[model samples]
Target: MHIEDHPVLGKQLQAPVKFYFNGQEYKAYKQQTVAAALIANGIKKFGLSRKLVQSRGLFCSRGRCCSCYMTVNGEDHVRTCMTRIDEGMIVSPNLEDPVIRSDRDGD
Candidate 1:
């Protein structure tokens, strides 16, 4: 779903790069963010809500919203919208419990 040519911006000139998401391979251009790549690949659901367990996707493309949080490499809570796609970079959905734990109760 990538825009091959923008009326104002013209054609994309960046070279394509490969990255993995949820063990699946996808292509993206250099300097493109992970969220952008995922969206381009038709991936709308990024994570789920804690309380209601509702499906969450890219709400704010900016880094302000936490809706786009995902796991990258071995790190959790990585903002996909702010993370640039790198060659061979591994990305996965955040599988950890989304519940906010209280410090008083140790899980």
Candidate 2:
């Protein structure tokens, strides 16, 4: 099955919104959350394990959960699931470091 037109989100979406991940450009809809936008761009894992350094990504849809949390605009620990995106926003990894593993690649 496929979505011909979304009933809740509407068929005609707003202008394509642009944001950056690891300094790379990408587009998303104006109505989408940061997490949604990232997911649309094929981002599977958005975070790393606190200790083990395993990959992490969104599990819960609501902001009450910290699963989608990441750094936005250089601020630490912002919830991507709660933040609605705007044009030309910049998103980057927020790893706790003194050391970055080879997995420091973008989502």
Candidate 3:
């Protein structure tokens, strides 16, 4: 879902970088976001919801929405849309919602 040739920007010049999605090797541009890269690879479903288990993907390409949350590089609850792709990076679905901690709970 990307413009191959922009009327103004023209052709893309970014080199491809290797990355892993749930243990499966995939390719993406160096400057592309994890979500955009995944979408470019024809991956529509990012993960399932915690309560309903409904499929979720890039609803708001912007980082304001949480629909694109996933695990990246051994970290939980990463917003894939806002994360840039890096070589050898690992991305995975957060199947279950992570526990949220509040400062008052520890006090």
TM-score of each: 0.85, 0.78, 0.84
Q: In model 2, where is the ten-residue run with the lowest total lDDT?
A: 98-107
Model 3: pairs clashing at backbone N, Cα or C within 3 Å: none
- Give one digit per residue, the lDDT tens place, for model 1 in 1-107: 88888889998747899999888999988878989999999998888777787888788889998899988886778899999888998988865664456554585
User: RMSD, model 1, all Cα superposed?
Assistant: 4.3
Best-matching candidate per TM-score: 1
Per-residue lDDT over 15-49 for candidate 2, one digit per residue giving the tens place of the 0 to 100 score:
68889988999888887888888988888677776
- For model 1, the local distance difference test gives 0.84
Model 1 alpha-carbon drift over 4 Å, by segment: 98-107
By TM-score, the candidates rank as 1, 3, 2
Q: Compute the lDDT of residue 94 as modeled in candidate 1.
A: 69
C-alpha local distance difference test of each model: 0.84, 0.76, 0.86
Query: Model 3 misses residue 73 by how many Å?
Result: 0.3
How much is 26 displaced in model 2, in angstroms?
Answer: 0.5
lDDT of 1 at 80: 92
Question: Best-fitting candidate, measured by lDDT?
Answer: 3
How many residue-pair clashes does candidate 3 contain?
Answer: 0
